[model samples]
Target: MTTDALIPHATGRADDPQVRRRAARVAGIGYLAIFVLAIFANFVVRGSLVHPGDAVATAADVAASESLFRAGLAAFVVVFLVDVPIAWALYVLFRPAGRDRSLLAAWFRIVYTLMLGVAAVFMFLGLQLVTGGPGSGTMGPEAGMLMFEAFDYAWLVGLVAFGVHLVLLGRLITASGLAPTWLGWALVVAGVAYGLDTMAVTLLPDYAAIADVMLLVVALPSVVAELSFTAWLLVTGWRRPRVAAETA
Candidate 1:
């Protein structure tokens, strides 16, 4: 009897190489959406709307640009929504490497998403606090500033979970031999950067003094890691040929 006849294949249909390739491509697109929308919302819109340590000014800025503030909130909502499928797609694409580890990574990302979603409520509340509507007069500029700061700190907390996900994902990708080893190393670096930055912000008394320098140090590796991985998924889908796995 042939070995094929004697030993049945254990892989499921979702485990098919073609399916994984398609999933990888979708995940890549999702990553691009996340990167672009997050940058726009967090940096561009928030930067324009907020003035550090000046609650009255920040509130005035947001109130003056109400439509823009709403748009930024919407962008964050979209990011939270996209994150759900990205988690599942990544789990599907990487599960072949180590199912348990992949699942753990996915859960970490999901937790981060949930935390961000909760944080977004603070953004919406900030809008209400700054708007010229009922209850707006009751709350002062300080209240609005507190809401915005809550949103920022909440996101920073979420980053901790996100960092864990990246570390697990980086390890998986490096071991899989399906992606460039350099990309995996970059991801590890990014993960470490995230953790360190979070610690600085949360635990350090001199966080403000060093914040800009820390951001500069963390930015490059994190951007390169994510963008490179994203481009690889979009362009190559997967490095390994489907035939090899199919025949095996």
Candidate 2:
């Protein structure tokens, strides 16, 4: 990284229209790809396989669909690969609003992404058990479930950081006045929902009983705000809005 890149410069460096536009485009595309792949891996692939409290079933599912499980893991790898560039793109896109805040937001997301990488490693552990690989004798269905749970909880912890990133991202959007203010607010609300849901899941032993409702609470806002923000990046972020408020 260049020295100029290391030190957070003032807003003027990022105020260039073309630069912001390019950053927006890059982030938009990367975000779209990661979102789609993640959803597919979690819902279509793992979702179908993993039973909340049933270890034998989960292990059997993974074994029956070993190839799909591998594909799902590959999908995660793709998301992580795309995540680094998205972090940099987001930083560039928002630094004009507030350099310090943008830098912090990017760091939060990078940290979260690394946590996701850890979750993927756990998924690999589960795969090893299913394939009769090393440690298979020592590991069984119960242990496989434990690995999967580890993946989920690790990723859940990561979401807290991701939530913070989203909140800061929302503030940047609103501060810059580069996109619709409502969208920014939506992002903020979504961030809070993410944190709250994570907290509940962590603290409440019977969270599963109300998982559906909480999922709605988090998923509704998350989908709406993030997808809308992605849409904005694609359609409107690069260009200056009719009224933009820049910080000094």
Candidate 3:
């Protein structure tokens, strides 16, 4: 059977302009949720509670503000959940460009989501240790600190997979003419930045001193890539002159 024949004609939603537009809006909302929740969890809550190399102080802060810590963990869980529909919306939005590639990108994102779920478990365990839950007496603050660190490292490791997903998704956006060419290139650059930063932190012990500087340089572009895309999807929907072949 031909490739065109393989596609289900009965389900015309994929080709409908209105449907695609709605998907874009949903994707925009998903991206916004991710950005907001991540910042709140990482900077606001953890920033106040966690004190690197000072397990006792960190544990005490967490204990004092256990509610905030729990809230942050809940945010992380919500972020992972939001990712599921985001991936599907993206695949639906871009499947017209290339079904196989779009599917591949979705799988990469789903895997990253799963990795984050595992990381969240560590964060929850860290909270339990701080709250003096079962075995907390034997484990102590040091063990709690270790679990928090594990949570951080696990998220970093998951970013490697996220980088690959962005690269694939960027290519799809560029090829489909669904958004601006520059936006696609920005996503590609963001993917590269993510990979390079992860490697620098993992491979070079001395890289920590310069890590903040490096993050400043690369992080802005990465943020711009997703934020701009999200804003565009929410505000403008998609560019005109949709691919005739795909839309037809």
Candidate 4:
């Protein structure tokens, strides 16, 4: 919550539109990049390899596509590094709306990023086990899969924090006209969906019955709402995307 104290003069720059605008651009670019990298790492690489119940096949697939798995690990590494700047960018961009709220949002995102970093560590450990690296401890697919799954669950926890961040941003957007008001509402919905899905996965012993539906619940709003916000930030430039008077 005391994030303003952590960053030098962040509060001092809150009223500066130039600073916020620049941060918005940086945030837009960072978001787009993170979006691409996360999709590749989560879907293209691990999605194709990590079988939920079949450790042996998962191992076989990863062993066959060792380089691809390694690339996924590398992508996660880059993601961890990039998330810090993006968090700062978001904080700086949104600070003008509400200093304490923006600071809290940034800290939430930073917490999420810490979880992501931990997830990446699990991913690296999984990779080392699979590839027989120094971190390997005679572990096979069972251990490897566990590490990979740990990565996933840790990432899930991060998403929970991300949901909170989105909710705060939604309020900021509605308050400040930084983006469309409808987009703020959509972000709130998306953020709630994220938290709901995380809770369902965490609390329910059997999630298969609701997993597909929950996936849609989370994915659609995120793709539409979050992407729309990012696009606005990219195109808005020095002009307001939506007039302040038009905000509801």
Computed on alpha carbons, the lDDT of every model, listed in order, comes to 0.84, 0.86, 0.84, 0.83
Give RMSD to native, each candidate: 6.6, 5.1, 5.9, 5.5
Task: Summarize candidate 3's per-residue lDDT along 1-248 as a digit string, tens digits.
Answer: 46333222325566677667656766787889999999999899988899988999999999999999999999999999999878887887787888899899999999889989999999999888877897677787899999999988888788888888999989988888877888888888888788788788899889879879878857887889988888887774444545765797
What lDDT tens digits, residue by residue, belong to model 1 across residues 208-246?
999889998789889989999899877765456767868
Candidate 4: which stretches are off by over 4 Å?
A: 1-12, 238-248
Candidate 2 stretches with Cα past 4 Å from truth are: 1-12, 237-248
- Residue 1's C-alpha lDDT in candidate 2? 45
Error of 1 at 204 (Å): 1.0
**Tens-digit lDDT string for candidate 2 (1-248):** 45444323234467766667767777888889998999989999999988878988888899999999999999998998889888988898788788899999999999899999999999999888766778789778888888899999999999999999999989888888877999999999999998999999999999989999999999999999999989988884445654564531
| Candidate ranking (lDDT, best to worst) | 2, 1, 3, 4
Error of 2 at 180 (Å): 1.1
Worst 10 residues of 3 by lDDT: 1-10
TM-score of each: 0.89, 0.90, 0.88, 0.89
User: How close to the true structure is residue 226 of candidate 2, measured as C-alpha lDDT?
Assistant: 90
Per-model clash counts, in order, read 0, 1, 0, 0
**To one decimal, what is the Cα RMSD in angstroms of model 1 from the true structure?**
6.6
